[model samples]
Target: MTVIAQLSDIHVRPHGVLYQDAVDSNAMFSAAVDSLNSNRPEPDLVVISGDLTDEGTVDEYQKLRELLARLRQPFVVMPGNHDNRGNLRAAFPDHPWLPGEGSLSFARDVGQLRLVALDTSVPGLHHGELDAASLAWLDDELTVHRDQTVVIFMHHPPFMTGIPYLDIYGLRNADALAMVLARHKNVDRILAGHVHRSMQTRLGNVPVLTCPSTTTQIALRVEADAQPASFLEPPAYMLHRWTGRGQPAVSHLCYVGRFEGPLPFA
Candidate 1:
């Protein structure tokens, strides 16, 4: 079995700074890291989907790099709408998978599972979209990896989440992405992180899910006129356990922070 730990929307702040002059995102991320280190069924890979920084700044990335050095597991990162591709690439010069130019997308194998990371971030915009080249790349990858269970991870989900404010900045060319995905059936699931809350949906006939942020969670409001807001929800992440080909992968939500004892059942 292979276990992949997914942490999303870190929004790391600049050194000695608090995110938005309010939440201490850096501390929250550190706590999350500690939680992962002590977690059972130690993960083989850690995937940080996006929103790596509150602002796409050099200082932020530098601070983020410093924080990530404490993580014990091997990990991969992709950009989100809040990230600057060039800065991100420069900060992680060791991650050769990130392309020298254009979107940061790559397909790599972890154990028996094929992990395909798509770059859905749009420059200078909060809404996400995939260009023609990226779509072509995805289609080609899916075609070549048909025999393996492929799990697509990106910063933005390809479906409307029904949250009024969030949907306003949702993926713009979702139809185009869906079209490309419809051509391939090897995709076991699509994972994302922009929503800052756990959500589930479907695209291209495959299951899609969003991971909760390690900092805050977006309020779950489906009303059409709901306002955009965030809350101090408990920091959390997902542990995706893949047993093998014949069996479906299971995802468990794990919360960060100390809690009361796990007493025996009465």
Candidate 2:
């Protein structure tokens, strides 16, 4: 069995600042890293979906790097709308997967699973789009790794989550992405961030899941004109376990705080 831990929207602060008004994003993220590091059975890898910083600043990224360095398992990160591609690449020069100056996209093989990271951030906008080049790269990568179970990682959810305020900034070229995914049968799941809530949906035959932010969660309001809002809900992360071929993958939403439980039912 191969287990992968997914954490998103860490939103690290510059120095001594809280996200929104209540969330100490830095503290929450530190706790989350500790949880992942101490998890039983241990995860093979950890993937941070995106939004590593609140403002995509150098100080924030530096702090993020410092905090993540404590993890025992290897970790990989993609960029979100709040991220600057050039800064991210500079912060991690060893990450050859990141291009010199374009969208950061690449594929890595771990055990029997093929992990594909896609850059959906649209330069200067909060909304995301998969440009022609990104789409082409995804298609080719999926085709080349057609025999292995592929999991996609990106910053944006390709489907709407009914949160009107958030949806307004949703991915713009979801249909185009769906077309590419439709041709690829090896894609087992598409993992994403930016939604700041735990959500599950389907894109074509592939399962698409969005992880809750490690910093804060957006309120789940469905009104068409709902305003942007966030809550101090307990931060969480996701664990995905693949039990070899022909078996369905299992996912668990893990809260980042300690809670008294696991007591045996009488």
Instruction: Give the least accurate 10-residue stretch of model 2, judged by summed lDDT.
Output: 14-23
C-alpha local distance difference test of each model: 0.92, 0.90
lDDT of 1 by residue, 197-259 (tens): 998888868889899999989998998888888999999999999899557689999999999
* Residue ranges of candidate 1 with Cα displaced over 4 Å: none
Candidate 2 colliding pairs, count = 0
Q: How far does residue 76 in candidate 1 sit from its true spot (Å)?
A: 0.6
Clashing pairs in 2: none
| Model 2 RMSD vs true structure | 1.2
| Stretches of model 2 off by over 4 angstroms after superposition | none
Model 2 TM-score? 0.97
